[model samples]
Target: GDSVTQTEGLVTLTEGLPVMLNCTYQTIYSNPFLFWYVHYLNESPRLLLKSSTDNKRTEHQGFHATLHKSSSSFHLQKSSAQLSDSALYYCALSDRTGNTRKLIFGLGTTLQVQP
Candidate 1:
């Protein structure tokens, strides 16, 4: 019963504010690939950040996060939120070894930014 969890389903905020979407996960496997994907309405989910090795943080496209097996979490954080950054975000993890193609996705966190 391994899975990923995103606590926030909807986040509404004004422009120029900070935003943090909580992400906690659990997996029986020792090695897991934590990922963050951004989907801009009608667009496909794209890779944002991925943890290649534990404790080594990964970041891309103005977003950053690290997979911590000790805490069993990979939370996304950003200093200032932008109106254009508003979109549906997902915290995902790909299964280990032979199941690399399989991804466990959270329900998804929707962010709404107002100018």
Candidate 2:
């Protein structure tokens, strides 16, 4: 079984501050694909970044995350936080079960950026 964890349920930050959302995962598979999905107020969740290679950094939409196999972590980070960056972020792990691939999502973290 595979599972993802997002330590922060809510993160509040002022504009221009650095942002970090902790994400960690555990799986029996040797190589697992990790992903970060962003959900806006009324929009469908979209993929922000994904990586299967260990120790490689993936970036999208001003956010970046590195997959660390040694620590089993894929923490999302941004140098500066903006109001537009506020959203619900989900950490997910890809799993393949009997020719089908599915994603296991975490509880999700809400990023609230204020002016």
Candidate 3:
């Protein structure tokens, strides 16, 4: 079965520091779309970035990630951390196996930024 894995459970950082959330995945299918979804305190989870092209960088909401099929990774990175950047982040892969494409998500990562 296909699965997504986020090695880091929690990341704590001070304002102005850089941040990285590790993400990796495994799948049996060849064509799959990887996504980064951010969930704030009250707002519903929303797609931050997504890409299926290997080695292409995708950016959204001040964050950027490049999917590397060779490494099976799509690590999210930000140049500087902001207090408002604290949130729950999830890495997901869409399995286009059948007529229905299912999204498999990694264990969520919580980012806490302090001023």
Per-residue lDDT over 78-102 for candidate 2, one digit per residue giving the tens place of the 0 to 100 score = 9999999999999998854456668
User: What does candidate 1's lDDT look like per residue over 1-115, in tens digits?
Assistant: 7789996678998888877887888887778888889899888898887876777777776677877889988988777889888999999977668944588998899998999
At residue 37, give the lDDT of candidate 2. 92
What are the Cα lDDT values of the candidates?
0.83, 0.90, 0.91
Clashes of each: 0, 0, 0
TM-score of 3: 0.93
* Stretches of model 1 off by over 4 angstroms after superposition: none
Q: C-alpha displacement of 106 in model 1, angstroms?
A: 0.5
The weakest ten consecutive residues by lDDT in model 1 span: 93-102
RMSD (Å) per prediction: 1.4, 1.6, 1.4
**Candidate 1 clashing pairs?**
none
Question: Model 3, residue 7: displacement in angstroms?
Answer: 3.0
**Residue 45: error of model 2 in Å?**
0.3
Best by lDDT: 3
What are the models' TM-scores? 0.91, 0.93, 0.93
**What is the per-residue lDDT of model 3 for residues 1-115, given as tens digits with 9 covering 90 to 100?**
8999995688999999998999999998787889999999899999999985889999887899999989899999999999999999999998656877688999899999999
